[model samples]
Target: MKGIVFLGERRLALVEVNDPTPGDGEVVVEIKASGMCGSDLHPYRALQDLSRPPESRVIGGHEPSGIVAAVGRGVPRHVALVGDRVMVHHYHGCTVCRHCRTGWPQLCEPITRTTYSANAHGAHAPYMKVSADTLVPLHDSLSFEAGAAIACGTGTAWGGLERLQPRGDETIAVFGQGPVGLSATLLASTRGSRVIAIDLDDDRLAMARQFGADETINAREANVAEVLRELTGGQGVEMVVETSGSPQAAAAGLQAIAVWGKVCMVGIGGKVTVDTQAMLDRQITVMTSYTMSTVAQKSCADFVVSRNLDLDRLFTHRWRLDQAEDAYRVFDAQVSGKGAFIF
Candidate 1:
């Protein structure tokens, strides 16, 4: 089989590798579509959070949708039969942990899970092996690309919305117009909430408007708090999802919410210096969101189908497996919208 490997220092290469054979309680999937995400940039830059050294050469895809080609020993029949389409939960954790028991394998208690493109073999190849429990059925109606997204971008957005539980009566502010941010906008709007989107890029801002943002703010040009305050009619938006790790956006998201409002942080990293006094006085709620739990992933897929969301519009670029290098270069530049590698 052939797969993509991160050679460190912003380098990626498609290399030949042994075909995956599932172990006990595992399944091997013939990948049909795999997504390139912001998190993949970490390994590309040699950040080393989860990726192993150059010698081991871990594969570099986390979100994938594919057909079941083989089931390992002890694999359950109810999960999927041969030829069934499915999405694998990117996080592979030790099942014994309390977190894993709740279907949040990404938050592995002692951190024993094998993360894609880091410690374990990822899906940017012809075949990938995953534990049976991580499998989530992909409805026959949804495209493989959409199924792939459910494990990462879409799933992360759903996780934030599930936790925040935005109501139609409230206004939502989503910071950052990345894939996760766009998903938040689309989902909140579909739920009938008035949404305000914040981002520096005009292209992303435009995309946000199409996704149902009532107003768009370019943080580079205006004070987000002021604009948000103005848009909400002096009463700040009740719910805010900050997907931009920028300290400025993070601080503004908290400050622009109404008293007792909730702020959900879905960005991966960076620090925000909070106003201790203001936070205490406002009776605010702030949640630091991680990746979606396994339950959340399934729920997101169901919701997407039920609502008939047009997420296919968000994906702007698609490359073949041979074009791995070009794919990351464009995605790393962040000039283009969401991109994927299609089989």
Candidate 2:
């Protein structure tokens, strides 16, 4: 088998590797779709080498969806059967932990936690082996690519929106129009909130408009705080979801937020200093959301199925596993909607 490996410094390659086999309590999934997430850029653009320390040399993809190819010993048919379509949660931890039992293995207390594409083998290849517990059934109505999106990027956006709890009569300003941010815009708009999408790129702003952003702001052309205030009739939006991970955007969100409004930070990036006095005076709430839990992942899938959201439209590019290098080369530009490796 061959898998994509990150060599760091904006370089990657498809390298040959041993074929995966299910171990005890694990299952091997024949990869159908593997999503490329923005977080992948962190390791891709970093100076540090991710291809070292043997274990860290794992395949590069965390958002995985596929069919069960094989199941290990003691794996019951009820847990997973060959040919069952599934979406992987991508994290494994000691099942005894409170977090793990609650379906948040990413927050497991044990050091034995395994994160696919980070410390364990992932679905960047033809086959990926994961703990059976991480499997979430993919609804028959949804495509594998949709399941892949719900596995991570879309799920992360859903998690953030769940935190913000935007209402139909309120307004929300979503910072950044990347995949996660775009998902937030789509979900928030469907929830009836007047959405104001902010991004540095007009292309993404246009994409946001298609996703139902009531208004768009080009951060580079206009002062985001000023535009947001003006758009909201000088009061500012009731909710802000910052997905750019830009300190400047975060600061601007705070500056332009309405008093008592809520802010949810979804992007993963640099630190942003908050004005404690301002927050205290405004009595607003600020919180950060990670990816969704296994239960939430299922709920997101259900929501997508119910809403008939054209999540497959989120993909602007799709390639075979062998095109990993070129696929990422284009994705790294950060201008495209989303990319995936379709098996």
Candidate 3:
């Protein structure tokens, strides 16, 4: 099998590697489509420290949609077959942990191994192995590419919004126009919440409006808090979904949140200075959500299947496994809205 290996900072090579076999309770998926996430660009930019020894060199992709190629022991035959189309969860937690027992396995007590972009072998190759427990069967109607997007971007958005619990009549502000923020805006609008989408890019703002944002604010143009206040009629937004991972955006999100409002931080950018005093004074509840659990992933898939959301529009470009390096280069440029690799 051929796959892209992350050798070091800004260094990735396409090389031939041995095919991975499924272990007990696991299954091997023939890669069909894999989406490149924003977080995946961190290592390439040297944003994430890579001084430690490499954990796994299988492939550097997490959001994968494929068909089952093989199954390992202890897995039911009906649950997975040789040709079954599926979406894989990139990170599989220790099922024995308290967090896993409560359906928050992303915060597993001991932190189980992950795939591709994380600590585990990923799907940016011809084949990838994943725990059978973490694989979700896609409906016949959903394409492999759409399934790939749902596993990470869409699922993360659903999980973040679930944490915030945005209601129908309340106004919610999403502080980014990336895939996660855009997905959140679409989901929030479907739930009847008025969405204020903020981003530095006017093109992304336009995309946000197409996805159902009631208002769009170019953060680079004006004071974000002031614009948000004006949109909300001076009451401020009821909830703030901070997905830019920018310090300024985080602070603005905090300042623009209504009294006692909930602020969910889903982006994983560098550290930001937050005003603890003002947050405490306003009685604001600050929360952060990580990757989605198996349950949340299934919920997101269900929503896509039932609601018929316009997921196909999210794909701006596609590449093959051999073009993996070019994919990263394009992502680093951030010129295209989004992209994926189809095997």
**Candidate 3 segments whose C-alpha is farther than 4 A from its true place:** 47-58
Candidate 1 backbone collisions, by pair? 50-118, 51-118
Report how far residue 284 has shifted in candidate 2, in Å.
1.3
How does each model score on lDDT? 0.87, 0.91, 0.83
TM-score for each predicted model, relative to the true structure: 0.96, 0.97, 0.93
Stronger candidate by lDDT (1 vs 2): 2
lDDT string, candidate 3, 245-327, tens digits: 88899889888988888899999974767788888887899999886877788888888878988787778889987777777
lDDT of candidate 2 at residue 68, scale 0 to 100: 98
lDDT for 173 (candidate 3): 94
Candidate with maximal TM-score = 2
The local distance difference test score of model 1 is 0.87
* Number of the top lDDT candidate: 2
Residues 203-274, model 2: lDDT tens digits: 899999999999999999999999999998899889999998999999999999999999999888869888
lDDT of 1 by residue, 157-224 (tens): 99999989876788999999888899899999999999999999899999999999999999889999
Q: Give model 1's TM-score versus the native structure.
A: 0.96
